[model samples]
Target: MKRIIAKQEHCMGCGLCEVGCAVQHSKSKDPIKAYNHEYPKPISRIRLELNKPVSFAIQCRHCENAPCVVACLTGAMTRDEETGFVKHNPEKCMGCWTCIMVCPYGAIKADVSGKIVAKCDACTELSVPVCVASCPNGALECKEVTS
Candidate 1:
């Protein structure tokens, strides 16, 4: 399966990934309009963290035995068999932060309404994640990883 891999050495932390992510998920598909709405708040499933010598974006790993899936009591989080992507259903979510707490990478984020959790789904509906497409520094990418 393909996963997004980050090279910290090549990262510039421009935050373009966040913008792309918001647009991709937005109903308007417009960054400005998307930012003004309630659904997508330009939430970057990938977060750029910088600490002097180290700087990189953190996102979901979509683990085969995902801890978030196990932590979700409402079955809101599940793995897609076809794509190997961990998916979230807001309708089934109960506003619990169990997945967020259990995720070691701190990738999951709360929706704008704060009623559900949100995270990278590997852009299963699109050819690629908006973050990967919007990255100007070539820091974020979708690549296959072998177990």
Candidate 2:
């Protein structure tokens, strides 16, 4: 499986990763519009974990046996066999937050206004995820791993 690995030692916690993710997922894909003009405000699938002296980025682990996939009551979450990525379908989601409760990493986030959830999709459409690409310090890396 291909996964994002975070090197906490190199992370500066500048939050550019969040900006990149929000812009990439925005309707206009514009950083300005994403932050200042978007009504709902695009959310970043990646989050930075910061402590006074340490920091790192985090997102969905895309578990080999994802609990979110199994706990989704409406079948909104599923793992793609070929890509080894966990996917979420908002249309099928009931907004019950079953998946949220089951996610061990607490990666899934609730979009209360939309009655949906959001998580990392690995930015599969692009060569690399915006979060990883935006890491100025090269703290985030994508690599293949055997599950």
Candidate 3:
């Protein structure tokens, strides 16, 4: 499976990854409009964690045995057998937050209304995820790894 890995030492905490993710997921797919014009605001699948001198970007790991998938009572969380990526079905989600509680990486997030969970889909629509491509300091990389 291809996964995004972060090198915290190289991260500068610029938050461009979050911006790119929001734009990519936005209806307008524009940075300004995604943040300023989009209703409920576009949510970034990737999150930046900062501790002064220490900072890093985080998103779903797409785990081989994703607990979120198991914990989801409504089956809204699922693992893509072919791609080894975890996916969420918002239409089926019950806003139960069971996935959020079970996610080991603390990667899942609630949408603006807190009605459903959100996490990285690895931007499967694009060749490369926006978060990795937008990393200014080479802090994020996409690599093939054994699942």
Candidate 4:
């Protein structure tokens, strides 16, 4: 399965991935409209892991031995064998923080409302993830990784 990989050294901290991701998830799917929307603004599945000199976009690793899936009591978190992507079902989620606590990379995060957990789904619904597509520096790439 293909996963988003980052070239940390090439990252310029431009943050276009965040913008694109949010817009893609928003109601209108328009940058301007999503930014200025009154309610339920879009949120990003991608996050820039910044630390002065080293910066990279971080998202779900979709681990082969996913701790998130093991920790989730409600069975909302699952690993798809065919796609090798860890899937999260918000409706089945009980807003439990088990997944967050066990994720080594701290990829999973709670929303502002705290009603559901969010993480990179690899944009399975689309051909390419917004973050990878919006990267101006070509720092983000989707490739298959061996467990």
What does candidate 2's lDDT look like per residue over 46-79, in tens digits?
8899995799999999999999999998889999
The TM-score measured for candidate 4 stands at: 0.93
- Candidate 3, residues 14-64, lDDT tens digits: the string is 999999988888899989888998898988989999997999999998988
RMSD of 2: 1.1
Each model's TM-score, in the order given?
Answer: 0.91, 0.96, 0.95, 0.93
> Model 4 residue 113 lDDT?
60
Candidate 1 lDDT for residue 114: 81
Candidate 4 overall Cα lDDT vs. reference?
0.88
Q: CA lDDT, every prediction?
A: 0.82, 0.90, 0.90, 0.88
Order the numbered candidates by TM-score, best leading. Answer: 2, 3, 4, 1
Poorly placed runs, candidate 3 (over 4 Å): none
By TM-score, the better pick of 1 and 4 is: 4
Least accurate 10 contiguous residues by lDDT in model 3 = 110-119
* Predicted structure 1: clash tally: 0
lDDT of 4 at 43: 81
RMSD of each: 1.7, 1.1, 1.1, 1.3
